[model samples]
Target: MVTRDSAWPGGVPCWVDLGVDDLDRARAFYGELLGWEAPPGSPETGGYSICLKNGRAVAGIGPKQGPPDVPPAWTTYLSVADADETARKISAAGGKLLVEPGDVMDAGRLAIAADPGGAVFGIWQSRAHTGIGLANEPGALCWNENMSRDYEANLAFYRSVFGYDYDDMSANGFRYSVFKVDGNPAGGIGELGADFPADIPPHWMAYFAVADTDAAVAKVTELGGGVLRTPWDTPYGRMAILGDSQGAVFAVIAMPAGG
Candidate 1:
Protein backbone atom coordinates (compact mmCIF):
# COMPACT_ATOMS: atom_id res chain seq x y z
CA MET A 1 0.00 0.00 0.00
CA VAL A 2 1.13 3.55 -0.73
CA THR A 3 1.04 5.94 2.19
CA ARG A 4 2.30 9.45 2.82
CA ASP A 5 2.34 11.73 5.79
CA SER A 6 3.47 14.80 3.88
CA ALA A 7 2.91 16.60 0.60
CA TRP A 8 3.12 14.70 -2.65
CA PRO A 9 5.60 15.65 -5.37
CA GLY A 10 4.58 18.23 -7.92
CA GLY A 11 2.36 16.96 -10.75
CA VAL A 12 1.20 13.88 -8.86
CA PRO A 13 -2.53 13.47 -8.25
CA CYS A 14 -2.51 14.03 -4.51
CA TRP A 15 -6.16 14.44 -3.66
CA VAL A 16 -9.75 13.98 -4.81
CA ASP A 17 -13.13 15.24 -3.63
CA LEU A 18 -16.78 15.13 -4.51
CA GLY A 19 -19.05 18.11 -4.61
CA VAL A 20 -22.54 16.85 -3.92
CA ASP A 21 -25.96 18.39 -3.55
CA ASP A 22 -26.53 16.64 -0.19
CA LEU A 23 -23.39 16.48 1.86
CA ASP A 24 -24.91 14.17 4.49
CA ARG A 25 -26.14 11.64 1.97
CA ALA A 26 -22.82 11.62 0.17
CA ARG A 27 -21.01 11.14 3.42
CA ALA A 28 -23.22 8.23 4.42
CA PHE A 29 -23.06 6.63 0.98
CA TYR A 30 -19.27 6.65 0.78
CA GLY A 31 -18.97 5.75 4.45
CA GLU A 32 -20.89 2.54 3.94
CA LEU A 33 -19.46 1.74 0.53
CA LEU A 34 -15.79 2.26 1.25
CA GLY A 35 -15.71 1.79 5.00
CA TRP A 36 -14.89 5.46 5.50
CA GLU A 37 -15.58 7.66 8.48
CA ALA A 38 -16.67 11.17 7.60
CA PRO A 39 -17.07 13.65 10.42
CA PRO A 40 -18.85 16.96 10.12
CA GLY A 41 -16.51 19.59 8.72
CA SER A 42 -15.60 22.77 10.53
CA PRO A 43 -17.94 25.66 9.89
CA GLU A 44 -15.10 27.95 8.89
CA THR A 45 -14.59 25.75 5.82
CA GLY A 46 -18.24 25.45 4.88
CA GLY A 47 -18.83 22.05 6.41
CA TYR A 48 -16.64 20.19 3.97
CA SER A 49 -16.53 16.56 5.08
CA ILE A 50 -13.26 14.69 5.01
CA CYS A 51 -13.63 10.94 4.54
CA LEU A 52 -11.15 8.77 6.33
CA LYS A 53 -10.16 5.15 5.98
CA ASN A 54 -8.38 3.37 8.79
CA GLY A 55 -8.17 6.75 10.51
CA ARG A 56 -6.25 8.24 7.59
CA ALA A 57 -7.51 10.95 5.26
CA VAL A 58 -8.80 9.43 2.02
CA ALA A 59 -11.06 11.90 0.23
CA GLY A 60 -13.54 14.74 0.75
CA ILE A 61 -17.23 15.46 0.25
CA GLY A 62 -18.64 18.96 0.26
CA PRO A 63 -21.75 20.91 -0.66
CA LYS A 64 -22.05 21.51 -4.37
CA GLN A 65 -21.00 24.90 -5.73
CA GLY A 66 -21.97 26.75 -8.93
CA PRO A 67 -25.40 26.82 -10.51
CA PRO A 68 -28.10 24.26 -9.82
CA ASP A 69 -27.82 23.02 -13.38
CA VAL A 70 -24.25 22.03 -12.69
CA PRO A 71 -24.44 18.46 -11.51
CA PRO A 72 -22.38 17.03 -8.68
CA ALA A 73 -18.96 15.74 -9.73
CA TRP A 74 -15.65 14.44 -8.49
CA THR A 75 -12.45 16.49 -8.88
CA THR A 76 -8.85 15.33 -8.91
CA TYR A 77 -6.17 17.66 -7.48
CA LEU A 78 -2.50 17.64 -8.47
CA SER A 79 0.19 18.61 -5.99
CA VAL A 80 2.17 21.69 -6.97
CA ALA A 81 5.03 23.59 -5.41
CA ASP A 82 3.38 26.92 -6.03
CA ALA A 83 -0.35 27.21 -6.68
CA ASP A 84 -0.10 30.86 -7.72
CA GLU A 85 2.57 30.07 -10.25
CA THR A 86 0.59 27.08 -11.48
CA ALA A 87 -2.50 29.24 -11.94
CA ARG A 88 -0.45 31.61 -14.08
CA LYS A 89 0.83 28.71 -16.15
CA ILE A 90 -2.73 27.49 -16.60
CA SER A 91 -3.84 30.84 -18.03
CA ALA A 92 -0.74 31.07 -20.22
CA ALA A 93 -1.38 27.56 -21.51
CA GLY A 94 -4.92 28.48 -22.63
CA GLY A 95 -6.74 27.09 -19.64
CA LYS A 96 -9.28 28.97 -17.51
CA LEU A 97 -9.11 29.41 -13.77
CA LEU A 98 -12.42 28.40 -12.25
CA VAL A 99 -11.14 29.31 -8.81
CA GLU A 100 -8.12 31.57 -8.49
CA PRO A 101 -5.33 30.61 -6.14
CA GLY A 102 -6.37 31.09 -2.52
CA ASP A 103 -5.81 29.62 0.89
CA VAL A 104 -8.18 27.13 2.51
CA MET A 105 -7.77 28.52 5.98
CA ASP A 106 -4.24 27.53 6.98
CA ALA A 107 -4.62 24.02 5.53
CA GLY A 108 -3.25 24.91 2.12
CA ARG A 109 -3.62 27.04 -0.99
CA LEU A 110 -5.42 25.84 -4.07
CA ALA A 111 -6.86 26.74 -7.46
CA ILE A 112 -9.34 25.05 -9.71
CA ALA A 113 -8.71 25.24 -13.42
CA ALA A 114 -9.92 23.74 -16.66
CA ASP A 115 -7.83 22.65 -19.58
CA PRO A 116 -8.45 24.00 -23.06
CA GLY A 117 -10.60 20.93 -23.64
CA GLY A 118 -12.58 21.90 -20.50
CA ALA A 119 -11.41 19.16 -18.18
CA VAL A 120 -11.42 20.65 -14.67
CA PHE A 121 -8.85 19.81 -12.01
CA GLY A 122 -7.23 21.42 -8.98
CA ILE A 123 -3.69 22.43 -8.11
CA TRP A 124 -2.71 22.28 -4.45
CA GLN A 125 0.18 23.87 -2.58
CA SER A 126 0.29 22.12 0.74
CA ARG A 127 0.61 23.90 4.09
CA ALA A 128 -0.61 22.54 7.43
CA HIS A 129 -2.58 19.87 5.65
CA THR A 130 -0.93 17.56 3.17
CA GLY A 131 -3.06 15.72 0.61
CA ILE A 132 -4.48 12.22 1.03
CA GLY A 133 -2.76 10.14 3.70
CA LEU A 134 -3.16 6.70 2.14
CA ALA A 135 -3.56 5.31 -1.34
CA ASN A 136 -3.21 2.18 -3.51
CA GLU A 137 -5.08 0.23 -0.85
CA PRO A 138 -8.69 -0.82 -0.65
CA GLY A 139 -11.00 2.09 0.11
CA ALA A 140 -8.40 4.68 -0.93
CA LEU A 141 -7.60 6.50 -4.16
CA CYS A 142 -5.77 4.32 -6.65
CA TRP A 143 -5.52 6.26 -9.87
CA ASN A 144 -6.53 9.34 -11.80
CA GLU A 145 -6.72 10.14 -15.53
CA ASN A 146 -7.97 12.78 -17.88
CA MET A 147 -10.43 11.90 -20.61
CA SER A 148 -10.31 14.61 -23.21
CA ARG A 149 -12.32 15.40 -26.29
CA ASP A 150 -9.66 17.65 -27.80
CA TYR A 151 -6.92 15.12 -27.17
CA GLU A 152 -3.89 16.74 -28.77
CA ALA A 153 -4.65 20.22 -27.54
CA ASN A 154 -5.20 19.03 -23.98
CA LEU A 155 -2.03 16.98 -24.12
CA ALA A 156 -0.02 19.97 -25.26
CA PHE A 157 -1.62 22.14 -22.62
CA TYR A 158 -0.69 19.81 -19.74
CA ARG A 159 2.87 19.35 -21.01
CA SER A 160 3.26 23.09 -21.24
CA VAL A 161 1.84 23.78 -17.79
CA PHE A 162 3.17 20.89 -15.72
CA GLY A 163 6.08 19.66 -17.81
CA TYR A 164 4.55 16.19 -17.97
CA ASP A 165 6.22 13.42 -19.98
CA TYR A 166 4.12 10.61 -21.34
CA ASP A 167 4.52 7.03 -22.47
CA ASP A 168 2.39 6.44 -25.53
CA MET A 169 0.06 3.48 -25.11
CA SER A 170 -2.21 4.04 -28.08
CA ALA A 171 -3.10 0.87 -29.87
CA ASN A 172 -5.85 -0.58 -32.04
CA GLY A 173 -7.36 2.85 -32.71
CA PHE A 174 -7.30 4.03 -29.10
CA ARG A 175 -5.18 7.08 -28.35
CA TYR A 176 -3.91 6.97 -24.79
CA SER A 177 -0.76 7.78 -22.87
CA VAL A 178 0.43 7.47 -19.29
CA PHE A 179 1.79 10.76 -18.01
CA LYS A 180 4.88 10.49 -15.88
CA VAL A 181 6.31 12.74 -13.17
CA ASP A 182 9.98 12.43 -12.28
CA GLY A 183 10.16 9.18 -14.28
CA ASN A 184 7.25 7.55 -12.44
CA PRO A 185 3.70 6.97 -13.68
CA ALA A 186 1.54 9.76 -12.27
CA GLY A 187 -1.68 9.46 -14.23
CA GLY A 188 -2.96 9.16 -17.78
CA ILE A 189 -4.63 10.89 -20.72
CA GLY A 190 -7.02 9.26 -23.13
CA GLU A 191 -8.95 10.44 -26.15
CA LEU A 192 -12.70 10.42 -25.74
CA GLY A 193 -13.35 8.99 -29.17
CA ALA A 194 -16.42 9.37 -31.36
CA ASP A 195 -18.21 6.57 -29.60
CA PHE A 196 -18.53 8.55 -26.35
CA PRO A 197 -21.68 10.58 -25.86
CA ALA A 198 -21.28 14.12 -27.16
CA ASP A 199 -22.89 15.66 -24.10
CA ILE A 200 -20.24 14.18 -21.83
CA PRO A 201 -17.63 16.85 -21.17
CA PRO A 202 -13.93 16.28 -20.90
CA HIS A 203 -13.07 15.57 -17.23
CA TRP A 204 -10.66 14.00 -14.82
CA MET A 205 -11.65 10.56 -13.48
CA ALA A 206 -10.70 9.41 -9.98
CA TYR A 207 -10.48 5.71 -9.22
CA PHE A 208 -10.70 4.10 -5.78
CA ALA A 209 -9.20 0.77 -4.96
CA VAL A 210 -11.58 -1.99 -3.93
CA ALA A 211 -10.93 -5.50 -2.81
CA ASP A 212 -13.71 -6.89 -5.02
CA THR A 213 -15.00 -4.93 -7.96
CA ASP A 214 -18.17 -6.97 -8.37
CA ALA A 215 -19.06 -6.75 -4.71
CA ALA A 216 -18.43 -3.03 -4.63
CA VAL A 217 -20.63 -2.48 -7.68
CA ALA A 218 -23.39 -4.39 -5.95
CA LYS A 219 -22.98 -2.27 -2.83
CA VAL A 220 -23.21 0.87 -4.93
CA THR A 221 -26.58 -0.32 -6.23
CA GLU A 222 -27.74 -1.19 -2.76
CA LEU A 223 -26.80 2.32 -1.68
CA GLY A 224 -28.92 3.83 -4.51
CA GLY A 225 -26.04 4.57 -6.89
CA GLY A 226 -26.14 3.53 -10.54
CA VAL A 227 -23.67 1.55 -12.54
CA LEU A 228 -22.30 3.26 -15.63
CA ARG A 229 -20.42 0.16 -16.73
CA THR A 230 -20.28 -3.39 -15.53
CA PRO A 231 -17.12 -4.79 -14.03
CA TRP A 232 -14.59 -6.04 -16.55
CA ASP A 233 -11.13 -7.46 -16.19
CA THR A 234 -8.04 -5.77 -17.57
CA PRO A 235 -4.41 -6.73 -17.21
CA TYR A 236 -4.08 -4.43 -14.24
CA GLY A 237 -7.42 -5.09 -12.55
CA ARG A 238 -11.13 -5.68 -12.66
CA MET A 239 -12.90 -2.37 -12.87
CA ALA A 240 -16.22 -0.60 -13.37
CA ILE A 241 -17.53 2.91 -13.72
CA LEU A 242 -20.26 4.06 -11.36
CA GLY A 243 -22.23 7.11 -10.34
CA ASP A 244 -23.20 8.06 -6.82
CA SER A 245 -26.82 8.54 -5.76
CA GLN A 246 -26.47 12.19 -6.79
CA GLY A 247 -24.94 11.31 -10.18
CA ALA A 248 -21.30 12.05 -9.37
CA VAL A 249 -19.18 9.62 -11.38
CA PHE A 250 -16.12 7.64 -10.29
CA ALA A 251 -14.48 4.26 -10.89
CA VAL A 252 -13.55 1.35 -8.68
CA ILE A 253 -10.84 -1.20 -9.38
CA ALA A 254 -9.67 -4.45 -7.79
CA MET A 255 -6.03 -4.52 -8.69
CA PRO A 256 -3.91 -7.58 -9.28
CA ALA A 257 -1.49 -8.28 -6.49
CA GLY A 258 1.18 -5.58 -6.36
CA GLY A 259 -0.40 -3.78 -9.31
Candidate 2:
Protein backbone atom coordinates (compact mmCIF):
# COMPACT_ATOMS: atom_id res chain seq x y z
CA MET A 1 0.00 0.00 0.00
CA VAL A 2 1.12 3.55 -0.65
CA THR A 3 2.22 5.35 2.47
CA ARG A 4 -0.49 7.71 3.61
CA ASP A 5 0.67 11.27 4.15
CA SER A 6 -1.59 13.58 6.11
CA ALA A 7 0.11 16.63 4.59
CA TRP A 8 -1.21 15.85 1.09
CA PRO A 9 -4.83 16.63 0.37
CA GLY A 10 -5.70 13.14 -0.90
CA GLY A 11 -2.80 10.78 -0.30
CA VAL A 12 -0.66 12.16 -3.11
CA PRO A 13 -1.74 12.67 -6.75
CA CYS A 14 -3.42 9.66 -8.30
CA TRP A 15 -3.12 10.45 -12.03
CA VAL A 16 -2.91 13.07 -14.77
CA ASP A 17 -4.38 13.67 -18.22
CA LEU A 18 -2.91 14.95 -21.46
CA GLY A 19 -4.59 16.96 -24.15
CA VAL A 20 -2.95 15.40 -27.14
CA ASP A 21 -3.07 16.42 -30.81
CA ASP A 22 -3.95 12.91 -31.94
CA LEU A 23 -5.10 10.44 -29.38
CA ASP A 24 -4.48 7.43 -31.61
CA ARG A 25 -0.86 8.33 -32.25
CA ALA A 26 -0.25 9.25 -28.63
CA ARG A 27 -1.61 5.89 -27.56
CA ALA A 28 0.63 4.11 -30.02
CA PHE A 29 3.81 5.87 -28.92
CA TYR A 30 3.22 5.40 -25.21
CA GLY A 31 2.24 1.78 -25.70
CA GLU A 32 5.46 1.14 -27.58
CA LEU A 33 7.70 3.19 -25.32
CA LEU A 34 6.39 2.32 -21.90
CA GLY A 35 4.61 -0.98 -22.54
CA TRP A 36 1.46 0.74 -21.35
CA GLU A 37 -1.99 0.21 -22.81
CA ALA A 38 -5.34 1.98 -22.98
CA PRO A 39 -8.84 1.03 -24.03
CA PRO A 40 -11.39 3.32 -25.66
CA GLY A 41 -14.36 4.48 -23.63
CA SER A 42 -18.08 5.23 -23.98
CA PRO A 43 -19.84 8.51 -24.82
CA GLU A 44 -21.04 8.58 -21.24
CA THR A 45 -17.55 9.91 -20.48
CA GLY A 46 -16.65 11.70 -23.71
CA GLY A 47 -15.06 8.54 -25.06
CA TYR A 48 -12.02 9.00 -22.83
CA SER A 49 -9.34 6.32 -22.63
CA ILE A 50 -7.66 5.55 -19.35
CA CYS A 51 -3.94 4.88 -19.82
CA LEU A 52 -2.91 1.77 -17.97
CA LYS A 53 0.30 0.26 -16.67
CA ASN A 54 0.42 -3.42 -15.81
CA GLY A 55 -3.32 -3.68 -16.47
CA ARG A 56 -4.21 -0.94 -13.99
CA ALA A 57 -5.21 2.68 -14.61
CA VAL A 58 -2.20 5.00 -14.53
CA ALA A 59 -3.33 8.13 -16.34
CA GLY A 60 -5.42 9.26 -19.31
CA ILE A 61 -5.07 10.07 -23.01
CA GLY A 62 -7.56 12.32 -24.75
CA PRO A 63 -7.84 14.65 -27.75
CA LYS A 64 -7.18 18.38 -27.72
CA GLN A 65 -10.79 19.19 -26.92
CA GLY A 66 -10.10 22.76 -25.87
CA PRO A 67 -9.23 25.87 -27.90
CA PRO A 68 -7.37 25.37 -31.17
CA ASP A 69 -4.23 27.27 -30.23
CA VAL A 70 -3.71 25.47 -26.92
CA PRO A 71 -0.58 23.36 -27.21
CA PRO A 72 -0.77 19.63 -26.63
CA ALA A 73 0.68 18.81 -23.23
CA TRP A 74 0.16 16.69 -20.15
CA THR A 75 -1.88 18.16 -17.25
CA THR A 76 -1.98 16.99 -13.66
CA TYR A 77 -5.08 16.96 -11.46
CA LEU A 78 -5.25 16.98 -7.67
CA SER A 79 -7.89 15.10 -5.79
CA VAL A 80 -10.08 17.50 -3.81
CA ALA A 81 -12.94 17.19 -1.38
CA ASP A 82 -15.29 19.33 -3.41
CA ALA A 83 -14.42 20.75 -6.81
CA ASP A 84 -17.13 23.42 -6.52
CA GLU A 85 -15.79 24.77 -3.26
CA THR A 86 -12.24 24.64 -4.59
CA ALA A 87 -13.29 26.65 -7.65
CA ARG A 88 -14.66 29.34 -5.39
CA LYS A 89 -11.45 29.44 -3.39
CA ILE A 90 -9.38 29.58 -6.56
CA SER A 91 -11.22 32.64 -7.89
CA ALA A 92 -11.10 34.36 -4.52
CA ALA A 93 -7.35 33.78 -4.54
CA GLY A 94 -6.89 35.58 -7.88
CA GLY A 95 -6.92 32.52 -10.15
CA LYS A 96 -9.29 32.17 -13.10
CA LEU A 97 -11.72 29.35 -13.66
CA LEU A 98 -11.60 27.72 -17.08
CA VAL A 99 -14.29 25.10 -16.52
CA GLU A 100 -16.90 25.12 -13.80
CA PRO A 101 -17.70 22.02 -11.82
CA GLY A 102 -19.31 19.55 -14.18
CA ASP A 103 -19.95 15.84 -14.18
CA VAL A 104 -18.47 13.74 -16.96
CA MET A 105 -20.88 10.86 -16.99
CA ASP A 106 -19.93 8.78 -13.95
CA ALA A 107 -16.22 9.41 -14.24
CA GLY A 108 -16.46 12.16 -11.63
CA ARG A 109 -17.12 15.87 -11.25
CA LEU A 110 -14.22 18.11 -12.22
CA ALA A 111 -13.32 21.74 -12.83
CA ILE A 112 -10.31 23.37 -14.39
CA ALA A 113 -8.66 26.47 -12.96
CA ALA A 114 -5.54 28.49 -13.50
CA ASP A 115 -3.30 29.77 -10.75
CA PRO A 116 -2.84 33.49 -10.26
CA GLY A 117 0.32 33.07 -12.31
CA GLY A 118 -1.60 31.37 -15.18
CA ALA A 119 -0.75 27.72 -14.55
CA VAL A 120 -3.68 25.34 -14.90
CA PHE A 121 -4.68 22.14 -13.05
CA GLY A 122 -7.87 20.22 -12.37
CA ILE A 123 -9.78 19.72 -9.16
CA TRP A 124 -11.48 16.35 -9.12
CA GLN A 125 -14.28 14.87 -6.97
CA SER A 126 -14.30 11.15 -7.36
CA ARG A 127 -17.29 8.83 -7.15
CA ALA A 128 -17.42 5.63 -9.18
CA HIS A 129 -13.95 6.49 -10.44
CA THR A 130 -11.64 7.25 -7.58
CA GLY A 131 -8.39 8.02 -9.47
CA ILE A 132 -5.44 6.51 -11.26
CA GLY A 133 -4.83 3.10 -9.81
CA LEU A 134 -1.06 3.30 -10.18
CA ALA A 135 1.66 5.93 -10.17
CA ASN A 136 5.43 6.44 -9.75
CA GLU A 137 6.01 3.42 -11.95
CA PRO A 138 8.34 3.49 -14.91
CA GLY A 139 5.52 4.23 -17.34
CA ALA A 140 3.36 6.36 -15.02
CA LEU A 141 3.35 10.04 -14.11
CA CYS A 142 5.65 10.81 -11.20
CA TRP A 143 6.04 14.56 -10.76
CA ASN A 144 4.18 17.76 -11.58
CA GLU A 145 5.06 21.46 -11.99
CA ASN A 146 3.55 24.84 -12.66
CA MET A 147 5.59 27.10 -14.91
CA SER A 148 4.01 30.34 -13.84
CA ARG A 149 4.58 34.00 -14.59
CA ASP A 150 4.05 35.64 -11.20
CA TYR A 151 5.80 33.88 -8.34
CA GLU A 152 4.20 35.77 -5.50
CA ALA A 153 0.73 35.53 -6.95
CA ASN A 154 1.11 31.80 -7.45
CA LEU A 155 2.19 31.30 -3.89
CA ALA A 156 -0.64 33.36 -2.45
CA PHE A 157 -3.22 31.75 -4.71
CA TYR A 158 -2.37 28.15 -3.77
CA ARG A 159 -2.03 28.99 -0.09
CA SER A 160 -5.58 30.26 -0.08
CA VAL A 161 -6.96 27.35 -2.07
CA PHE A 162 -5.09 24.32 -0.70
CA GLY A 163 -3.37 25.68 2.39
CA TYR A 164 0.12 24.87 1.15
CA ASP A 165 3.57 25.95 2.27
CA TYR A 166 6.70 26.13 0.14
CA ASP A 167 10.42 26.76 0.41
CA ASP A 168 12.80 28.14 -2.20
CA MET A 169 15.69 25.88 -3.09
CA SER A 170 18.68 27.01 -5.10
CA ALA A 171 19.36 23.98 -7.19
CA ASN A 172 21.36 23.61 -10.41
CA GLY A 173 22.08 27.36 -10.34
CA PHE A 174 18.41 28.26 -10.63
CA ARG A 175 16.03 28.96 -7.78
CA TYR A 176 13.37 26.22 -7.83
CA SER A 177 10.07 26.66 -6.02
CA VAL A 178 9.17 23.40 -4.31
CA PHE A 179 5.54 22.81 -3.36
CA LYS A 180 4.44 21.25 -0.11
CA VAL A 181 0.97 20.54 1.17
CA ASP A 182 0.89 21.07 4.93
CA GLY A 183 4.51 19.93 5.08
CA ASN A 184 5.18 17.20 2.46
CA PRO A 185 6.44 17.96 -1.04
CA ALA A 186 3.64 18.08 -3.62
CA GLY A 187 5.43 19.51 -6.64
CA GLY A 188 7.49 22.43 -7.88
CA ILE A 189 6.97 25.73 -9.70
CA GLY A 190 9.28 27.59 -12.06
CA GLU A 191 9.31 31.20 -13.26
CA LEU A 192 8.89 31.38 -17.03
CA GLY A 193 7.26 34.74 -17.65
CA ALA A 194 10.24 36.43 -19.32
CA ASP A 195 11.95 33.25 -20.32
CA PHE A 196 9.11 32.39 -22.70
CA PRO A 197 7.79 34.73 -25.35
CA ALA A 198 4.42 36.45 -25.01
CA ASP A 199 3.01 34.19 -27.72
CA ILE A 200 3.95 31.11 -25.69
CA PRO A 201 1.27 29.90 -23.35
CA PRO A 202 1.66 29.12 -19.64
CA HIS A 203 0.60 25.70 -18.48
CA TRP A 204 1.35 22.93 -15.98
CA MET A 205 3.64 20.15 -17.19
CA ALA A 206 3.61 16.57 -15.80
CA TYR A 207 6.69 14.43 -15.48
CA PHE A 208 6.83 10.64 -15.90
CA ALA A 209 9.40 8.76 -13.88
CA VAL A 210 11.39 6.44 -16.09
CA ALA A 211 13.82 3.77 -15.05
CA ASP A 212 16.52 5.25 -17.26
CA THR A 213 16.32 8.64 -18.94
CA ASP A 214 18.76 7.73 -21.70
CA ALA A 215 16.88 4.56 -22.60
CA ALA A 216 13.55 6.35 -22.52
CA VAL A 217 14.80 9.10 -24.84
CA ALA A 218 16.14 6.58 -27.29
CA LYS A 219 12.95 4.52 -27.07
CA VAL A 220 10.80 7.58 -27.57
CA THR A 221 12.72 8.40 -30.73
CA GLU A 222 12.43 4.83 -31.91
CA LEU A 223 8.68 5.08 -31.39
CA GLY A 224 8.42 8.25 -33.58
CA GLY A 225 8.58 10.66 -30.64
CA GLY A 226 10.83 13.74 -30.48
CA VAL A 227 13.39 14.83 -27.92
CA LEU A 228 13.03 18.58 -27.49
CA ARG A 229 16.01 18.60 -25.15
CA THR A 230 18.67 15.95 -24.71
CA PRO A 231 19.23 14.20 -21.42
CA TRP A 232 20.87 16.42 -18.84
CA ASP A 233 21.65 16.23 -15.14
CA THR A 234 19.57 18.36 -12.82
CA PRO A 235 20.40 18.55 -9.15
CA TYR A 236 17.37 16.38 -8.50
CA GLY A 237 18.07 13.78 -11.20
CA ARG A 238 18.65 13.12 -14.90
CA MET A 239 15.87 14.19 -17.23
CA ALA A 240 14.99 14.76 -20.86
CA ILE A 241 12.22 16.44 -22.83
CA LEU A 242 10.20 13.93 -24.88
CA GLY A 243 7.21 14.08 -27.14
CA ASP A 244 4.73 11.37 -28.04
CA SER A 245 4.21 10.26 -31.60
CA GLN A 246 1.33 12.72 -31.88
CA GLY A 247 3.49 15.73 -30.95
CA ALA A 248 2.29 15.82 -27.36
CA VAL A 249 5.30 16.87 -25.30
CA PHE A 250 6.08 15.76 -21.72
CA ALA A 251 9.11 14.87 -19.60
CA VAL A 252 10.88 11.83 -18.16
CA ILE A 253 13.10 11.87 -15.10
CA ALA A 254 15.33 9.18 -13.56
CA MET A 255 16.00 9.91 -9.92
CA PRO A 256 19.04 8.61 -8.12
CA ALA A 257 18.39 5.19 -6.60
CA GLY A 258 18.05 4.73 -2.83
CA GLY A 259 17.00 8.32 -2.08
Question: Which model scores highest in TM-score?
Answer: 1
Residue pairs in candidate 2 whose N, alpha carbon or C atoms collide under 3 angstroms: none
TM-scores of the candidates are: 0.98, 0.89
Q: Per-residue lDDT of 6-120 in model 1, one digit per residue for the tens? A: 9999999999999988889999999989999999898886889888999899998998888999999999999999999999999999999999999998889999999998899
Error of 1 at 151 (Å): 1.0
Q: For each candidate in the order shown, give its overall lDDT on alpha carbons.
A: 0.93, 0.75
> What does candidate 2 score in Cα RMSD to the true structure?
2.8
List residue ranges in candidate 1 displaced over 4 A.
Answer: none
